[model samples]
Target: MGTMTPAQRRALYESARFARETTYNGPLGPEYTPAGTRLRLWAPTAEQAAVNLYRKGHDSPCIGTLPLQRGPQGVWSIWLPGDQHGHYYTFTVTVDGVARETGDPYARAGGLNGLRSMIVDLARTAPAGWERDVRPVIPPARRSVWEVSVRDFSQDAASGVRPAWRGKFLAFTQTGTTLHGDGIHPTCLNYLKRLGVGYVQLMPIFDFGSVDEAKPLLRQYNWGYDPTNYNFPEGSYSTDPARGEVRVRECKEMIAALHAAGIGVIMDVVYNHMYRYENVLNNTVPDYFFRQNEDGSLSNGSGCGNEFASERPMARKYMIDSLLYWAQEYHIDGFRFDLMGLYDVDTMNAARAALDALPGGRDILMYGEPWQGGGSQLHRYEANKANLAMLNERIGIFCDDTRDAIKGGCFNAREPGYVEGKPGSFWDVGGAVAAWCRSDRLPPHAPSQIVSYVSAHDNFTLWDKLLCVRYERPEFTASDPVALAQNRLAAGICLTSFGLPFLQAGEEFARTKKGVGNSYHSSPALNRLDWARAGQYHALVDYYRGLLALRAAFPRLGTTDRHAPEALQFFSLEQPLVGWALPAAPGDGAWWRALCVFYNPTDTSRVVPLPAGQWKLLSNGTSSSLWRGESRTYERKALLMPYSATVFGAV
Candidate 1:
């Protein structure tokens, strides 16, 4: 090995200029065709490249080896004639005379733990009636998203999922599942419909490195944030990890079932950084995939060791291509990017445009965390909170401003937001309602770009966070009047406010993780959605349902542009007391001509003024109903409940 000349360095200028000069997006992984599978890889620096045929997915020796011919654009290709669908393969590339073996970065499916890439027809892996599967259409303003984990979704015995399918992708296919006590109440799929959420943002289902897909899963738990195989469904979520088809087919079955239930599935994808820096993408193109510091070390932007040099042409191509593959192959309704801020603005826009080009792509929701994990040199091309205006519309960014303003700062678990009774800044609350939450919170951009949520998989559940500051007990229960009231208040504020309403799985019933802030590796005891609590706190569940129904009735509540005077008008009131009104459809027969909401986070109740006409009270924080049976009418003023939200519809 010797130092490169300036001419050679100019030819391969920092890998970026060199990559920009070359174009090859035709195909990189194994091409499963009628004539067999043609394996191809891009390794410009490779001295030699070969395909090692393995007998099994794990702990298997190579049965045969086939040398790949160096082709144009540095792509090594080997054409295998005859059936090679079931065969497992790995690329052995010698970079700088040092041999490194790895799986396909573009593999649609993979063997156990993603140690080897599996060759198969992706279409054949789809469940029956997959082609006919129709993704439920949901307007950006009306999508109520619930973040859920595949394992925790049904791992509980109380979930009524059969033992065989308890934690697998097949659990979603189980309909009419019931809890332990009643043996009749809806639990899994039926429970989702009962909850009335349009989309369930599944925690990373792509093959990740944290959990062993081969071993019994009862001993292991993770949120699946560490991705090993970007395209394939997580093997642990499938009935069988050895057979790659099972994971693929079962994942399709889950998506199809969700569609049948009128619920769309949003995949949580970690594209910023993978579990390992020396992964397939790195093994094949060592210095091409990741960003590097001046010392030639990988950048730690993702806080997960290495970040994709996303600005590079080929790297960006792989990301966008993978996103399209999931949309086209698995029929994934939407995508929620993990650590999306690491993605360059151009790359995010490119992905948005590509997804939009699909048949029903407009209905598909696209959103992500617009804040990077740690350090980055990509501030020039950052797709972050400060630069929301620079990105394309329809690509939503998480509203942490509204999140902290309404509930409290996410980083400081013990801090109090408005609902937690800290008398928080109403400006941020107004901004949240505005979908911009406020200018200090963010620029008053398009409503579609704001994803307003209080709790997700990243931190503590809303219940746990509320408990951390209020209670001493570590029990994951939905008890205590003020705590329950506060929980309901948080939901009420987010639902009634602008942007896409999102909550964690079982947050309606105060799903707690025993006060554990980061339960990414916690036991199943803490993660599973306690169905018994749904029965215990049925009233709270009803309140959340009512709010969702009201939101559905007023779709623009989630989609209305911030500061849109025609849609929302603020009622002049005392400081820290936020009140707004939305004019309903013009008609006398309508249940109400206008919808008004007032939020009070104080210990003492206050008389909030109402409009001239007679108004029917819809919710008192605890009960969020649009109907007027339990509550009475008010003309001038209504007593705002203590630490609660009050809703009134003008008659």
Candidate 2:
């Protein structure tokens, strides 16, 4: 690399944007800090750039200023005094005229809606009293994930403290010690330990538009997808939103706590679009950041007001820098991309590279929801699929197969109940499973690339789905407690299945959101976790715990090796029931595990024959019935119970 013309530099930026290196968090190695305070920004078009610090309660508030020298490509940087750590600063770019963007590229804090950004001293207040002395250490590869929202996670009734930990950038960034905060309650962590989960996938915590902006009937529900600043965490979740200082510190504390507990935190990031109202895009070069439609309006590809113009080098750099800041500062374990399909393949590849170069580069996990193009329309994101295959070769995907299989075609659909001798809901999952089973098509990095789940935040509760298809017919409601047992059975399938098991915050005891399908806007009543339900669904919860322990005991269950489709046999002779088996490997001397998954959906007792070998029941709709197999099942009439799913094993 040598010094070149401005045109060549522009081309370099454009070309690098397409290269594999761009997919990663940029400058993965070594901190370039040479002095007390440093400033950096990823601005390409500016001829001159300077840092301006502004403080509260002042007429002429800009206290300190420093000019930045442009480095290679578009990076402009300057070093500051060590004492200037907690300052609020923003960048002023002068190309043809003065234009202010958000915050400094290397700004540790302060970016809230492009008004002002924070200058943080990680040394002074890092959790565990860390002195931020160590060099840059990137993140590690993400293994398992646990999705959680802070608002409904816990309640400190006595102290009158709620989940003060809103999704924030700082919560995932700090390192070297355990974070101390009420947010890291025993309930959430204990659940993580029980599930063998490694990562906590947090929803959006950026300083986004008010909740009122996302009301369902308002024809505008941003879901925090419309990012105002790449750096600021959402302030609404914090206790003191006006200052934003408490939010920053508390978030970092939360991250430190999770890290101390040996659990990783991953933020749900949105880079596809910016806010439609009161944004820098509307103030500055509007077309510079947004994708424009034929009528010169913002394109609505992300279902938000606009989509980012990743085709441009500057915009691409902004996203890369934002993500890198999160990884380096927050120490996040992984990222769950929402609607990643909207971004181009090359751009995503660049992002992957940037992340891959970090300290834990190779280990950092990156996953995404591969949705794309147009409002109310789904596009086949080749980028998303390619990224899934390419990334899973490194990371993994939130597999929709188990979810779709247990439910119907979509995540929101409910199961058609446990009908014997009939095709159950998600039968098509067999095809998806069969596809993954094909070794030739599997990603090369890991044996298991899919993160399987029976329920997620996007759909109705597993319990609600059960009641709809099992207990009620014409009108579906969860008030009837008759179908409660069926709900437990579904949870069993989630825990015992092959892929990673993700339990939505409160599904352990079968929580339902009334009849609301997409309740993103419902009151806390819709989202709150009912601790009492844990007791009611204790049997199911215990059953899940046993299954989790069983899976841990047997690595074979989690094995990614898939059986040959034809060799994978399904027996229909057992009428009113379905039997599937994977014969023992040719040379392997292990006892073959014959699976006879029987479902009696109706209220009738249907008799079915048992499989060969010393028959034992692996599970039979109840926790106590799990793990303990009945040895005497060598009988003629197998009594099938209503809304029951039984797994029989051949010893």
Candidate 3:
């Protein structure tokens, strides 16, 4: 996904090596501290900038009174050590002799208002980047990962509480959700603990303008996409927004809470660009950061107004440093890079290396959207050991295949004979499932990785997709308002599929965003999960819970190894129902069981061939029931009632 033209590829070695090497010269300085605080802010256009520390009890201290030193290039730095906790600090700079502006240069945490900078208790902070205690431990022989977002987790904040005996570092995982006061709600942590997801992937929490900042039509607040600051979590979501110190402290507290809940934290970072285009950083450091066109225009590589010149060593260093700071300071479990392709391949690898050198390298999860501007294909991303393709062995990606399969468009499943279903219909659902089912079949050059999900923050909810698919083809729509049984079937497909399954905050009860596929501009109603849906569709909710339990119980079902699609044999008759059979391994008599999965997209009885024998029903869509194994001849096939999916095994 690294940016490049075909010409650049031909002479890639030269052009790629030094395409954009400018350093990021914005907000560069040491951490403010108590010997007094020598403060520095990036003010290229300032005649002079001074640090003014305002303490609660002491007299107002100005830069001149301290050891403040104004360096060349307008970087004003000085050692002011008398500062301490409860001290409020800001930089006042005089520009053009008359213009004066005051702001926080290095806010550990706060919103875009940037009225003040918070003091830090570095002693309590987590290591910034990798966890050096562990080396590169090869991934488990099998991995069963479930993705959960924090915001949409149950309202009970304590739901993520883990056993007291298990410490945070030992049991960290990832979950995601809408930003709430003081990070993801406790309910998210509790739900993740109960659900046993390995990680929590949080959406953007940086300072962004209100929807009102843009046009009215785009005025909505379901997502956290509008970003103003790259370094801090938005103060609005913190417990105490009025006090920057409190907000910063609360953020660390939130991370600690999640760790205690036994869930790793993966921040959804928007490093591709920033908000307030005319902010001091971009305007003051001009050519030192952003990419420029040959004609002197801005390069819109990130689909944003401008893309950071990550190719630049300083830009890369800044990003890497920030990442390390978060990993070490906050004990963040992983990072989900936003618009990852905007960064250079080498730079990405370097960041990964830096993380690997950190304290918890073995547990760090690094993954992202391997695309840029919608034009780049996921496969087109850099293939280096650090890229998503290679990282899949270590990290992973938001697998589009799972989305496409349930929609029916995975691999050869689209072509004739490749898949059996209502002919000529877009197998979009099937395609989405294919990512999970057919992933092992991907080219060897591709990483053996998959991030399976029916829906995510960027697209329509799975329910919305089902409705659209039904609308596009009336045959798929339901005659009764029962929310379409096919929708339930699709859910089963995802929970049962291979690889990591990412559940959006609200997909459990078929939450809908009113078909506004990209609900980034929608309000809380569209994004906030209506927990009531659990009562509305108790059947489906229980279904997913059972599925998770089943995955946890059966190691063979969730193997992360490379397995060819042929390992699974698909069978169907008259094509209304499709069945997959996973044969057991040799020598393992208990493992020799065959799971015949049947999916009926129709509203009638489906008689599926089951190698006639008294077979036990491992699980039925309706409830929890275990049927004893019975002997039978391969004569009569099992019968599946309309609009359902059943998994059976030889008794």
* TM-score per candidate, chains pooled: 0.95, 0.75, 0.73
Top model by TM-score, which number? 1
Off by over 4 Å in 1: 1-17, 437-440, 472-478, 560-567, 585-592, 626-633
Across residues 558-594, which tens digit of lDDT does each residue of candidate 3 receive? 4545553346676645654567766554433332266
Tens digits of lDDT, candidate 1, 586-632: 43233567788999877788998887888888888777774736568
Candidate-wise lDDT, in order: 0.82, 0.53, 0.52
Ranking by TM-score: 1, 2, 3
lDDT of 3: 0.52
lDDT of 2: 0.53
Question: What is the descending lDDT order?
Answer: 1, 2, 3
Cα RMSD to native, each candidate?
A: 2.6, 7.3, 8.4
Candidate 3 RMSD to the correct structure:
8.4
Report the C-alpha lDDT of model 2 over 467-522, residue by residue, as the tens digit. Answer: 55544442443344445555555554554454545667666667676756766656
- Higher-lDDT candidate of 1 and 2: 1
